[model samples]
Structure formats: structure tokens, C-alpha cells
Target: MNRSVVKRVVIGKPLKTRELGDQKINKLKALAILSSDALSSVAYGTEQILIVLAGIGFLAYWYSIPIAVGILVLLTALILSYRQIIYAYPKGGGAYIVSKKNLGENAGLIAGGSLLVDYILTVAVSISAGTDAITSAFPGLHGYNVPIACLLVLFITILNLRGITESASVLAYPVYLFVLALIILLGKGLWDVLNGQVPESLHTPIGTAVPGISLFLLLKAFSSGCSALTGVEAISNAVPSFKEPSAKNAVRTLTMMGIILAVLFSGITFLAFWYGISPKAEETVVSQIASTVFGRNFFYYFIQVTTALILVLAANTGFAAFPLLAVNLATDKYMPRIFTIRGDRLGYSNGIVTLGAASILLIILFEGHTEMLIPLYAVGVFIPFTLSQSGMIRKWAKEKPSGWQLKLSVNLVGALITFTVLIILFTTKFPQVWPVFVFLPIIVIIFHKINAHYNDVANQLRIEGAYRREKLKGNIVILPVAGITKVVENSLAYAETVGDTVIAVYVAFDRESEKKMEEKWNAYRPDIRLVTLHSQYRSLIRPLRRFIDVIEEKGEEHRNSVTVIVPQFITKKSWHNILHNQSSLLLKAHLLYRRNVIVTTVPYHLKK
Candidate 1:
């Protein structure tokens, strides 16, 4: 049976199944899903500040509060802008949809590339940050950061594969508990500060300032704090994850997430400042604040546990966003088409696995160090931020009514602000974060180019009525045989089936092998016509290619009808395939250049 024919029969019509049930996610549930990644960032979002400030000495902790405030301002602006997105394009293309519809393919590609890189980094940073917290609890795991991070990535990937509703349901409690724990801790810290009974630092000399306070240090601290806003854009990508009235529900969810994040960020930053948190004096600002409030009591343990749990869940955001983005890109032909296909569970399995592998690699490369990866991180996030806002502005400009000038003016202002921030982010961070910023876009551009090339080739090969008119006037088939093997037998059989004049061509790379092969051919069959081409160059495809050209130039009648039947051995096990060669594939490609000739493969499968 022909494989293509069998495929057609097996896939006769699309099967209808209720795999994705009509479960409508309300605003709260949608918020849970969208905020899973961003909320989780509270676990180690300030890890960069602690690490960087520590390097600059303990006094830098004071600046962390102000920087966190700046980041909060940016986050608030982004949330407001994205509210418009949830209202406008609720189908969940996120930044990609916004840019593509309004700014063109290049802008869309830039947005897509940036978002993709950011998501991958989010996974790596989150998992590693979680590992850091875990290691703090159990110093025994200190040396296994990469292994633990990779395992966590795989674990998150599995949870995501269980389906969106399932993941959201399972994560809701932990995320809620995390929020509650932070609120309690922050409240306790403030009460202590107001009472003037602030817990003393473990190290009395910790508050001393370092010597330098350069612009570079400030930018570094800003970038570090910027990580808290990492997952704010997730809501934009998760528009479809909501139930009916997707846009309205998405906007509601977005609003909820914005409020929650704002409140949490403000509380956390305030507590850290009130307690005189120092990155140099502690590994994490949260940990430092925890120690100050709880004084190594049960409350401290509770904070550690919840913080770790939340950071681990931060990777969940990547787990969710990766698949949706993959589906969108695959639909646009930017990725393998298989990524676009949902599994029985209504999950993008291929996309999940791809994301998992990428995250693991990043985790290993940065050794799960979120601080080191933070500078490299925001470049991807803000590129999409700027372009998507610009896209939204363009949309409003073109679609808004004359009477709606006020609303359009707000969008224009948002776009300008976002664009300016994007410039500052890139200019400020790209030099230090050059590796990720420079490399990620290049990778996406390469993918775009490759996809474009495939599209162009596919267009050229698309058959029409005129294609048959250009077919060879006379029938000729070239069958390349190696030995008295099943592959050779299958090739001869298929050649006979073509109902045309056929030639069995063989190339002799060496005198000894050629002599042995010729003798064997004669001994096996004396009646068949065998044409041997000898090459001292030890090249197989080139000699066979030249022979076909010789046959073509003999006459137009000969050139008009040539069909090459190349026998390829197919093995079920990929490793077994390595034992064979790829000369047949090369020959088939070379034959395609000849005018009026068709190339077909006769595959001989090995028996198990």
C-alpha cells in the first residue's frame, strides 16, 4: 500500500471530538493563569538587586526601594496599555498579532522574536531562582543547580501538558497562598517598623555604603528590579484561555492581575526598605526581610517554603505562553507545522517539549543564576513592549472615529512613552547584555529566512495543468543499483512499473570494487542491460549526474522524457539508517534540475 494513499484514507476527514470542553474560565481563573508567571517572580525577582548590590557593597540596599518604585511605575503603565490589548484583540496573538496587523511583518517578527527570547529566559531564571531558594534551605543541593533546574523545567512542562484548565486549577492554591504569605509578612514588618522595634540585622556592620555610586550601578540596579515585571505581558498572550466573552473576561483578568501585582510589589518593596534590606547582608531581599520579621521562627520557614513554591510556579507562565506562541508562529509558517497541532488533551505537546529543552539549556548555561541573566533578560521583553504599543497606536489612529480623538490621544501618548523606554532599555542594557540581545534576534531572523526559502521552493514546485504539458516527450528512467540487495530489487521492480525504457546505472569508485560488482552483476543476471560509469575522483553523485546530462544532450526526444527511480533503504530504527548512505537523496536533487524530468523514490523497508 502507498503511504500517501494510506494517509489520505486514514485522514479522510477531520474527526470532531469534544477534547477541549466548553469550560469557560471566569475572570478569577483567567487571572490565576495569566498571573501565575508574574506572581511567581516575587520569589526571586529581587535576586538581581541583592546580587548586584552586594557586589557594590551593602549600602546599595537603600537604592533598591527607589528602583523598585520605578519598576512599579513602568509595570503600571504596561498594565494600562495591555488592558487596551485585551479589549481589542482577544484571540491572544499578544504582541505578535498587534504588530502584524498594524506595523507589518518586520515589526511583528521583531515583537515575536523578543517575546520568545523573554519567555525562554523567564523559565530559566524562574527555575534557577527557585533552586537558589531551595538550596538556601538545604545547603546539600548547593552543587546541583543545573540538574535541579533542568528537572524542575521538565516537571513544569509535564504539568502544562496536562492541559491549561488542569494546570490553572492545581496552581491556583499555591499562588493564592503565596500572595497571602507575602501580605502577612509585609504587614508584620510594617507593624514592627511603626512600633520602633525593628529586628536588628544579624551583622551590625551590614548597613555601611560602598565607595562608588556610578550611573552604571544605578542602571544595573534598575535592570535587576525590572525583573519583577517579567510576566506582566502573559495576559496578552492568554486571551483565548478565557471562556466566552474572551475579550471582556481577559480585560477583567488583566485588571485583577495588574492590581494584585501592583499591591504585592509595593508591599514587598516597602517592607524591604523599612527593614533596611541589604543584598550584601543577605542572599535575597525577601529572605533578609523574612529574617528581620520572623527572627528564625516558624514564620521564616513559612516564608521560605512559599517563596520557593511561587518561584517554581513562575516557570508555569513560560509553560503556558510557549505553546500559544508556538501555535501562532507555526500557523504563520515560522515554525514546524506540527507545533500548531493540539494533542488529545488540547495542549501543544511539541511546543511544550521544545520549550522545556530550551529552558534546560539556558538553566545550565547561566547555572540558574537569575541575577546574571537579568540584564540579558529585559531586552527581549521591552522590544516587544515598544513595538506592540506602537502597533496599538497605529490601530487606533486608523480605526478611531473623529469624535474619539481623546481616546486616540491616550494611545499615542502610551506609544511614545513605551517607545522611549524601549530605547533606554536597549541602549542601557544591550552593551552589557549583548550576548542574549544580539543572539536571540539573529536566531529568529534565521528562522524567518529559512521559512521564507521553504515557502518559495514550495511555490515553485506546486503542480498545475501546465506542469504536465512541460513533461518529457519521451519516457526514460534511470535506476541506480548498488548490489544484489532488496533495495536494488525494489528499484528494478518500480522501474519496470513506470512503463518506459529503463537503464540500470552503477558507478565504480575504485577498480577493485568495480571489478567485483561487475562480476557479481553478470553472475546474478546475464540478460539485464547494465551501464557502468567509472570515476577516479571517487565521487558517486557527480558521476551519475554527468551520465544523466550526457543522455539528455543526445537529443530533445531523449531530454523530453526522463524519470529517475532512486532506490532508498528505509529502516524503522533511525540508528540503523546511519549504516546506509544518502547518495540517493543527493542524486534525486540533482536530477530535479533537468528540464522535463520527474524524480521518484522506491523505498525498500527492512524486515523486523
Candidate 2:
């Protein structure tokens, strides 16, 4: 099969422009797709809290509920805050766009850098944690886990390249499955408590003390639990991906996501409290909770499997939003122009590939350790969250449309709250979060450089002076040909059209070859001078360049400028170009940088 045909098979047929409406998913599918990262965070969000609390022994476990409540309060305010964002910038005003427009370039770049790091870490940490879920169950295959995580990333990337809607379909079932399992566990545990059939595990003394709970410890636990908020911005960022009346659909998804995150996160924390589940070295808190609830039976395995599957698939959220963010950045010239090019599936193919490559590097660098990857997660997310919330405040105050005061107040609260959390996270996590600050400045500098390059290019390319019709510049066009073939004939034809004075130059390695070339040229008599030169060293570009210099040395009245019309022979297959030496490309590149010389390639595509 042809390569394109294979691609079509893998990604499905390309959708037409009008058919984009068909990709707008329903609310249930939207919830599963968009909310996966935030919802799946329950698997590790509670674990992260427990990890912090476990430092002071079992007594610290009680704080998990309170810390979770704090996180929940933030989640609710953030949900409402971002709902305003979705409506105001329904065209999908992610932090970068929102902040840049309202908060200025620096703030926007800050948000962009933060979101970029966060999305990449989302893929890395999500997959690593997902792999941990499996390894926690099996334990034997833990040694080969980094590679396993990378394979999972690759699988998701391929599915995303197929198109967002298709990726959502593939992701929906597993995500919903994970949700169902958790509900079953939470519901069953709650039922048992109400019916007065509480298990023995619930009496396992969660109040055991070492250092006990302290203010600093509670702050750390709260910050760890903020991982649940990592993907919250994704819905706002991807608002344009929603259906007709996009803002309405987006608000619906955002509300449902917020509610689901609250219920799952709250239930798990409560259940952990009820079951006396604490973090362990060998297994996770969720795993421990599952074992206690259902005694490690099939339902337990089902929960573990669904948990692993959803955690790995949580990367799908990054896969969806990162590319859309790239497209928006590219349109604003903060990124490369190539990022704007959509794939056959109406997706940003360049952005997807770049995201996948960046993710693979993160997975390898972190070596798939969830502990190493976790502390680095919150910083990236909160920066964007704060900046976006702050930007929303500006959006409301300036736009000040209907209900703008209330909207402004909500965003103000969200901004202050998220920013406070950010400050706490930075202070408590100064060591772990330092890399984010370092990497952020580096990325912001890159964005500046890209913007500078684009501006400089636009300045250079823009038509400055008044458009006056003048005779085209006087010129000598040189056609460099190897032999009297169709390619040469084509080049000469184009050269004649370009310049009044056209010359065909050929570099022959030996005198015999030079004589045969001159004889053949004379026999064809193409109404132009055929200049042939022999070389002892057989360096074609060097001799051809020297010949052009000799022509310029004349300083004749007609020799005002010179153009090198190089003939480019194109093979049918891209790989076929590798079979033959790229002499034409070499010659063109050779002439390209020379002062006062212009190069043009006349393509003669082969019919092979």
C-alpha cells in the first residue's frame, strides 16, 4: 500500500472543512475526554496528600480531609472563574491568549511557558503514575517501567494524530469505566458505614502519631493535593473544540468536570479516612483502600486495571490541549509558522509531534519515578492558573459587560486564592519548583527571540517604498547543466524567459568529456552560447562559481547582475532522492550565500 494510503488507514480519511461540525462531541464523551486528567488525578491526588501526611506518621492522615476541603474550595472557585473565561473568550482564550491580551506580553509569555511545561509534565507524570499503578500491582516488572511509560505516550500520540474526536472516542470508555469503579467503591463503602457493618480495617488507628500535624505540614499536604487542579485549565483552553454555541457546550463540560473532580476527590479522601488507608512503601493508598474495601478480589483488580488505563490515558488531555495551544501560539507568532499547519485530520500535526517528542524526553529524564515527577507538577499548573485568573479579572473590568462586577469579583477571588497557593507552593517547594523558574525564563527568552525573528522578517519582506513601475533589473542568467537532456533543456528554456543574456555553463572533469559536451551542444544549436570547462580536481561547484566570477570580471554594461538557474530533478518518492547524490542541491546551496548572486531552481519532476 502507498504511504498516504497507509496514513489514511491509520488516521482515517481527512475531514472536509464543512465536516468539522461532525467532530463536536456530545456532553458525556466531552466529559470523559476533557475531564480525564482532572478526574484521573483522584488516583494520585489523594496519594500525594497521604505521602505528605505520612511523613508525620498515621496521625497526619486526619489532615487529608481538611486539606482536601481546602483544595475543593479552590476547585469550586476556579471552576466558576474559568466558566467566566470560557464565555468571555469562547474562541478559546487559554492563559497565554487571555493574559497576553489583558495583562501584556510578559504576563502572557509567563502563562505560555508555564502551560507548556505543565502540559509536558502532565504527559510524563500521568504516564509514570499510571505505570506505577500497574507496577504496584505486579511489582516484578518495575525495572523496565520507563520504557513502558514511553510506549504508552507513543500509543496516545498516535491515537491523537488520528484526530481529536477519534481520540476522545477511544479515551471515553476507559475514563468512564474508571469513574464507574470509583463510584462503586465509594458507594459500597458509604453503604457499609450507614448499615452498621463497618469493617475491621476502619478501626486500624489512623490517629497514630510521630511528629503530628502542624501548619507547615498541612500546607504541604494541601499543595500536594492541588494536583487535582492541573488539568482544570484544559477545558477553557480547548473551548473552541466544543460544538455549536461553543461557549454553552464548554460551560457544560467545565461544570460537569468540576463536579466530577469534587465528588471523586472528596469521596476518595473520605474513604481513605474511613478505611484507615495510609501510604505505604510497597503499595499505593488507593490500592490499599481497594484491598480493604473489597479484599483484593476481581472488583479490586478491575479498579486497579481501570485506574492504570485511565491514568495512562490521562495523557490524552495533554495530547488534545497542547496542540491547540501551539496553534494559538503559532498564530500569534510566539511559535514557529509550521505549527499552524493542520494535519489531514484537521489537527495541528507539527504540534502533536513536538509534544510527543518533548514528552518522551521528560519520561526518560525522570526515569518514570512518580515521586521525582510529582513535586515538579504543581508549580507549572498554578502559574498558569493564577495568571489566567488574573487575566480574567482584567478581562471583566475592561469589558465590563453585563454582570461584569460579579464576574470581576469572582475572578479577583480566584486570582488571589490561586496566587496565594502558588506562593505557598513556591515557598514550601522552593527546591523542587526552582527548575520551573529556571526553565521558564529560558522558554520566555525563546519566545522573545521567535517574536523578534518574525518582526524582523516582516520588516524585511514588507514593501516599503512606493510601487513605481520600472524596467526589471538588467541581468545575466546562467543555466548550469550536466548534459543535453530534458532537464537541461527545461532549465535553458526558463533562463531564456528570465534574462535577455542567457548562458549555459557545464563543468567537465576530463578534456574528452568536455569535447563531447561542446560537440553535442553545437549539434543541438539551442540559440545560446554553451560554455564548457575541464577540471583536474573535478570539483563541480568550485569551477562553476569561478566561471561566474570570470563573467562578472568583464564589468560590461549588460553585466549588472547574475542569476544562477539551477535545474532540480525531482524523484517520485522522497526516499528515491537519497539514492542519487544531491549535486543540484549542493550547487544551489553553494550559490545561495555568495554576495550579489541570485539562485533559482527550475524543477523538472520525474515521471517515475
Candidate 3:
């Protein structure tokens, strides 16, 4: 009985007009995309401050307000600086392009590497934050954080796989509702405070003393709260994803995001201070403010639902930006080529899978604890922040500015401010954060070195001018054959085409089988000469090597142009077929290493 394997070929269809067409996202949708990260910050950014403050006690809740305000100032400066990025380089490379064009490839690689790590952390942090919020609503979910987190990651992956516009459209309304609910809650809290009806905090019974406010503590808190601004840079990377007048739309989106973040952050901080919202005593400042203003009734539940929805949607920011940034990095040859190829749906499939898996792992490692992840978070974000801003400074320095001298000065100040913030972040948080920061740069540097090595090896192996100019006038053709099959016939035919002095060579494992094969070859092709080499190891490679050495010693000039033909059978089923046991492919690979030895394969296809 004979078995035949069939290979299936797939044909690809072009994207339909709607799929390939640009997304006509209005101001709201664009705002939703840009603010997806910032709006979601309300869910955990305050919690992160509280977590840090909790270490000191409930009295430190007052510090959250000033910290939030500090974050707002930095966010405003960042937004203005990025507006320049949108105007100057509208392409999606964002920090990578800015760094590469100004500082050089090493700076670009550093920025790209930092941003890549930040995107992965964004996914992990968002998912962990969402998991905590969900567990708060359902206490039974305490131990199931990892499973639920992975499920959330899987769900987000599916949404992204559907396409970017589709995912944004799905999340738009819920994100909007989250913003409205937050505003309403903050407004009501302020109204109560204005009327001298400030409600007592539910968690005040925890009765904790605030830590003494030092410059270092304040800077640490400010850097932690700056987690709110982590995703603002995504807009610069996603400029091309916008519709017509891409740069204008990106700048508009950036402005809207900045305004929204500032208002929500400032209002929340005010309400937190006015009502004494404390995570040291209470888990979430938003929930505490919600319960205080709206009571523990339907409004509180509504706020909880919307808050959770927004946190989940915050992960959408990473979903949208990671793939785009990865594509840019891949294009620059700093990353694997797979990231550069888009899926059938025009999404970065590799980036999506990679981002989701990494985020889920981080969530599990942190036990879905946003606090534990926060220290690690700011390190990645600020590395890119300082590098990209430095790139912008270099860019302005190089350009001959005419009308925008003030703008250039603003960029310089912006770079200085961000650089200072980065220094503070590294110094204050590095004890807890440095381990993560150290590993990422090490991995990136290792990958860069590996790629460089691969390119160097490939360059050496490539045929050069001198090698190609040499003629193979007197080389002998050695055709290795086995049995009286089509593989042997094909090898013989090809060898004849190369030159007239062609000999069929074979290795005999034993004398009996050797005699049978030699008789068969003579019957099949009497015109062809046959030579057999005896092998003690039962391996073809050793015998072939010995045979070639013998031929070379006879005449060096003849050896310089020799061609080796090996008849190889092409099996339809890749797994089941074994032609030379363990040595066939290895033999061909070894032969390829030698100079002046040309190896040719004669494939024999089996009919069904």
C-alpha cells in the first residue's frame, strides 16, 4: 500500500473598502481614543496614591490633592510638548522618530525600547486595576484574580482582533458615561462642601496619622500620581490612525485629552480633599466620594459600574497603541520582523498577542495588585519621557527657527521639567523599581546585539564580486545516488547538464546491498559511470568527505571547480518521512560550509 500527502494552498482576499478605508473619528471618538488611558486613571491613579499614603497612614490623604495637582501641571506641559510632536512629525513613530532624527539610532532604540516596556506595563497595570475593582464588587473573586485577569486579557485581544475602529466604537459610550458620572459625583461633593455639609469619611475610624510632608515624600507621591499621564504619549504614536488632516486631528485629540484629564484629575483631587477621601481608610477615593455624595443607594452602584467599565477600557489604550508602536520599532529593524506585518484585518496581530500575554503575566505576578505594579510602572514610562523630550530639544536646536522662538524655548523648558521629574522618579522609586528597569534594558540590548551578529554572519556568507567572477572550467561533477528510483534519474539528468565528466557516486553500508544497488544503477543508466565508497560508521557524510579529499589530492586544480549533486526525495508528509535517518539534512548543511563546493538538490515527487 502507498500513502500520498496533499498540500493545501490558501488564497488571500483583499480588504473590502470599509475595512481599508480611514476611520472618520469625530472629536468625541478621537477624544475617546486619546483619553482612554487618562479617563481610566481615575479608577487606579488615586488608589496608587492612597496605597503609598497608606504606608504612612490615613492623614496622608490630604497629600493626594497636592499630588494630583502636581500631576496636572506635568500633564499640561506634556500635552503642549506633544502638540509640537504632532505638528513636526505626524508619522506614527512618535518618540522613536523624534529620537532617531535628532539624537541618533542608539537614542531612538532606547526610546523605542522604553516605550515598548511602558506599553506592556500599561496593559498589565490596567488589567490589574480592573481586576481589583471587580473583586471589590464581588469579594468572592479575591483568589481568582489571575484567571479573571487572563480572561479579561483574552476578551480585549478578541476586540482588538476585530479591528481598531470597531474596538474604539464599542468602548466609546461607556468611557463617556464614566467621565460624566465622575464629573457629577465631584460636582455634588463640592456643592456639599460649599454648603458646609461635608460628610465624614467612612474610613476615618482607621484613625491614622499623616506622615510628615518632606520634599522627597511629596516628589515620590507626585511621581506615583503621574501614572495618570502614562498614556498621553500614545496620541503622538497614533496620529496616522486618524482621518484626513492627520496631524490636525491628532493635535485636536491631544488637546481634548489634556483638558479632560486636567478637569477630572483636579476635580477629583478637590472633591477628595473637601470630603477627605482616603484609601488608607477606604479602598477607593472615587467610591468613598460616591457613597458620601450619592449615599449607598442606586447612584453609588451606578458610579461603581461606570468606574469599573472605564478601568477595563483603560486597557484599550494599550490595545490601540502597543501594536502601532511595535510596528514602527519593527520597521526600524530594532524589533522582530513579525511585528511589522499586519494581519488580515489590518491590525498588528503579533503585537496584540504579545501585549495581552505580557499584561496577563504581570497581573498574575502582581496578584492583580495595582499598588505593587505602580512602583514598576513609572520607571518604564519616564525613561521614554525624558529621552523623547531630549530628542525634541535636539530637534529644535538643529532647526533654524524664525517665527516660533518662544515655542522652541517652551520645548526646552518642557524637556528640562520632564528630565527633572524623571530624575526624581528614578531616585525616589528606584529602590523598588530598579529591578524591573534593569531587566528590560538588558533584554533590549541583548536582542540588539543578537540581530547585529546575525546580520554580520549573513553578510559574510553572501556571494561577492571576486567569488562570482571565477570560472568552474575543469571541475568534476560528483552525483551521489541510491536505488533505481526517479530521484537517481533526476540527479543524473541535472549532473549531465552541468558537465560531461559526471560520475554517479554511492556509499555502501554493506557489501550485499552495495552489489544490489550497483547492478540496479547499471541497468537503469549504462552510459553513466559508478563509484562506491565503503563506510565503517554507516554514515554518508564521513564517506563523502573522505571521497572528496581523495579527489582533491589527485589534482588541486580539478578540485577548485567541483560540483556535488545529491539526489533527495521530497516527501509530501513532512513528519512521517525519513530519508537518511538523522544525517541527511545535516550532511547538506555541512557541505554548504566548504568553499568551492556547490551542492545541488534533485527533488523527486511521488505520485498518488
lDDT of each: 0.72, 0.81, 0.72
- Least accurate stretch of 10 residues (summed lDDT) in model 1? 464-473
Using TM-score as the yardstick, the better of models 1 and 2 is 2
Runs of candidate 1 exceeding 4 Å displacement: 1-16, 46-65, 199-217, 402-406, 427-431, 461-608
TM-score of each: 0.70, 0.77, 0.71
lDDT of 2 at 550: 78
lDDT by residue for model 3 over 4-115, one digit each (tens)?
1110111122233235444345556767755787778866677667667666666667777667867777887788888998889988778878888888877787777777
**If ranked by lDDT, best first, what sequence of candidates would result?**
2, 3, 1
| Candidate 1 C-alpha lDDT tens digits along 92-149 | 8789889988999878877887788788888887788788888878999899988988
Top TM-score hit:
2
Best by lDDT: 2
| Candidate 3 regions with alpha-carbon error over 4 angstroms | 1-19, 23-27, 50-63, 199-211, 457-608
Q: Deviation in angstroms for 16 in model 3?
A: 4.7
